[model samples]
Target chain A: MTSLVIAGKTFHSRLFLGTGKFSSNQLMQQAIETSGTEMVTVAMKRVDLHTPEDNMLEYINKETIQLLPNTSGARNAREAVFAAQMMQEIFETNWLKLEIHPDPRYLLPDPVETLKATEELVKLGFVVLPYISADPVLCKLLEEVGAATVMPLGAPIGSNKGLRTKDLLEIIIEQSNIPVVVDAGIGAPSHAAEAMEIGADAVLINTAIAVAGDPNVMAQAFKMAVESGRMAYEAQLATPHREADASSPLTAFLD
Target chain B: MNLKLEILNHNNMNIIINNNSREVAEGCTLERLIDEIGYKEFKFAVAVNNQVVKKTAWDETILYDGDKVIVIKAVSGG
Candidate 1:
């Protein structure tokens, strides 16, 4: 497998997992270990004083997998910045997945707020990965603002519609100076393979694996799919021709 | 006479924790507040009036009346 380097750190697996929507923490751990993802995202929430909760951090083996705490519920830059600071204190890792989507219905990332947060977070010494729409210009601007990576969504988050923004993603991938991680809306292994084949540096998956009938098996499948796609990309896929050229020895059967 | 003064102090020390009005003893620190709620065992971050209070500062950071304390921690997310 080819390596993915982001912010001077190398990741052998191109897959990044999200720690959410799992049937159980043990299952999530098993699936994560099965998938061999180098990084996983976790969100921040207020602890309910009434209920005793299980800390998911104990289940994740920090010795192997890096924790990427995200600012998921933050509606704007200020909230995001605050969350990022708390995440820094809790996780003790400067790596952050900056997501600012004010609209709850679609969870579409607010591009303006995302950009603003990225600038501030980057300045605060956080290795910022801003999730954004598949806009090439925005990707370029984010890169200019010192984002470690640009995570452009394949579709609306958790929608699993699969690469609704393929054309635009291609543009972003082509022009991006930093890694382009195709995050969100990847519903199937094929979707992951497609993103990898298109030269995406990596892909972040959540719903497809977490909500699967068998998430462990699904994670294994996704791992293989990502590897296959990346291999095909590295080997340089062959171009298609409009008309078929007679390259096969079909006439040899008669001989 | 002492019981009356203690009751009055408790009434005067009311603060909002996670948006719920509650009363704490006079000179209650952030550490004591979290310890009372059994959160000291867990890994969490606290913000007093929208400013993040580091864990090291929790011991000396005292809670005042009507103070808004937001305690947050890592949860599952994508």
Candidate 2:
């Protein structure tokens, strides 16, 4: 399997993990270790900030695990920018996962504000990875504005709907110069495998593994699937012919 | 002549903290209030009346009567 290279950093695993919805922080940590994902996402929020030993951070903070703090609750470009700055101030990392969704119900990303925010964040010397819809044009625009990586969601956030936007994602993968990390709604290992098979730089799984009956096992499964799929893609998969030839050779083309 | 005595420390001051109405001592600095609430050495973000107060400024940033203070920390979210 080819290693994923994003912004001069090399990641051995193509499966990026999201630290959310797990039964416990211990379980989340175990699943992350099992998955072998070098990159993981953590959301910034207003909780018990004074507790130096936040359960999730205690579990995931390591030299090996790179935390990409996301602006999940931001409703606009300004709010997202503020959240990103806060993350930088608190976490001491310029890397930010920009998420701007005004609508709270479905949590759909606003393409206009996302593009605007990506440009601004990039200018602010941040390694911005904006989570956006599977719009090929928007991905190109983000690339033009200097995004470190473009994370396009496969389906809705946490719906476990698999790659419902497969066609658009395929277009995005084809056109993007930066890494295309398929970011949400990956239901199972097979779904992750399909994404890797289609040449996505990586797949970010959260709800599927976090809410699994056995997250550790599920993480392992996704790790294997991602590796396997990347290997197949690297080996050059042959395209299947639409029409199958008859065994008896009913019509000899050579004749 | 009639005069109304202002008892500052004798009466509990009503204030809004983390969106909850709470009684704290009058003239409490944010740092002292935070320490009083057992949040010393804890990593958190604070906002007073919608303005964020950094950790360095918390010492001088005092809570006033009816002032809304918001204290937030990291949580499990995606």
DockQ of each: 0.79, 0.37
* Model 2: docking quality category: acceptable
Q: What is each model's TM-score for chain A?
A: 0.97, 0.93
Which stretch of 10 consecutive residues in model 1 chain A shows the poorest summed lDDT? A246-255
Tens digits of lDDT, candidate 1, A1-255: 679999999999999999899989998999899999999999888878899888889899998998999999899999999999999888989999999999999899999999999999899899999999999999999999999999999999899999999999999988988999999999999999999999999999999999999999999999999999999999999888999877777665656
TM-score of each: 0.96, 0.86
Q: What is the Cα-based lDDT of residue A214 in candidate 2?
A: 95
Cα misplacement distance, residue B10 of candidate 2 (Å)? 9.7
Q: What is the per-residue lDDT of model 1 for residues B1-78, given as tens digits with 9 covering 90 to 100?
A: 999998887656888878888888778999998888885557888899999999999999988988999888778889
Best by TM-score, which number? 1
Highest-DockQ candidate: 1
Off by over 4 Å in 2: A48-54, A245-255, B1-15, B22-29, B39-42, B60-67
Tens digits of lDDT, candidate 2, B1-78: 123334644555877877678788777788887776674444566678877777798899878889988766555566
Model 2 residue B3 CA deviation in Å: 10
Give the deviation of candidate 2 from the true structure as CA RMSD: 4.1
TM-score of chain A of 2: 0.93
